[model samples]
Target: MIVGGAIFQLCWVVRDIAVAQQAFTEQYGVADWFSIPDVHFGTESAELRGVPTDYTISVALGYAGGQQLELIEPRDGVSLYSEQLERIGPGLHHAAWVPDDYDAALTEACAAGIEIVARGRFDDIGMEFAYLDGGSIGSYIELMRLSEEMKAMFDHLIPAGFTNPWQ
Candidate 1:
């Protein structure tokens, strides 16, 4: 249990965000989808396998009960999301945990020989995340660190622009 936190989010990588959102909404009954479009991770903001890389993606976040559901569509450049979509098509990609002690959890995971496949930060939102190779597990595991401001924003995410279709 390297992550060692309650899983709060589930993410799927898709070819088309709008199609994925509609299917998820209809099938899972997610209340609303909050779109975060054209998220750019500059070379300074992200890394792939410890090498700085630039990429773009669009994400839609929704809620079903306490769990947050996410749909990610790669827009440009190379990333784990795009690679997974190419290798496996579309389906569950990762489960995420926000540990109470983010740094400690990350340190421990690294100390335990877990491979960090990707990592990035949204500086404007004071948030960072890492994707860990799950090894024997089929899907990757994500660890997220969110600032208080980011947490507050996430609390009201659904209401900010509810039902925002992909763009």
Candidate 2:
């Protein structure tokens, strides 16, 4: 299995994003949350276990150290967040890895028994991401194919004077 990239994001499914983001900011000192609401996965473009669905969710992102802490709240529909919250309560959902070689990283994750659970394209950013269910570990792993546009956007969020991650 390919194993060079490091985990970049820690995602959680929360019952109330507004409250959760506040809690995280206060408790962990992870401030400056960038809120993104009504994330739309087109009717035919998004899928869960191969079944298409027009699921939407709200998300708030904050950087803790060098890793992103994402808090997600399920909207008025059935979605990955909804299912996870129903079965496991509001807690850690997935950890994302931004790999240089997206295809090879996916192949390695799959070879290690991480099965694709949900996938969709973010048309606005021209990037695609997939969530793999890390079966035995009982958590999910998201593999994001970082496009140039996505990189540029995230780079802007770098903390303080450490704008360069490579430094």
TM-score of each: 0.91, 0.90
**lDDT, residue 129, candidate 2:** 84
lDDT (Cα, 0-100) at 19 in candidate 1: 95
* Whole-model Cα lDDT of every candidate shown, in order: 0.86, 0.81
For residues 18-68, write the lDDT of model 1, one tens digit per residue.
999998888988868899899999999999999999999999998876667
Give the CA lDDT, 0 to 100, for residue 97 in model 2: 74
Range of the 10 consecutive residues with the lowest summed lDDT in candidate 1 = 158-167
Over 4 Å off in model 1, which ranges? 158-167
Q: Residue 109's C-alpha lDDT in candidate 2?
A: 77
Prediction-by-prediction clash tally: 0, 0
Model 2 error, position 63 (Å)? 0.9
Please tell me which predicted candidate would have the highest lDDT against the true structure: 1
Residue 16 of model 2, lDDT score: 95
Off by over 4 Å in 2: 111-113, 161-167
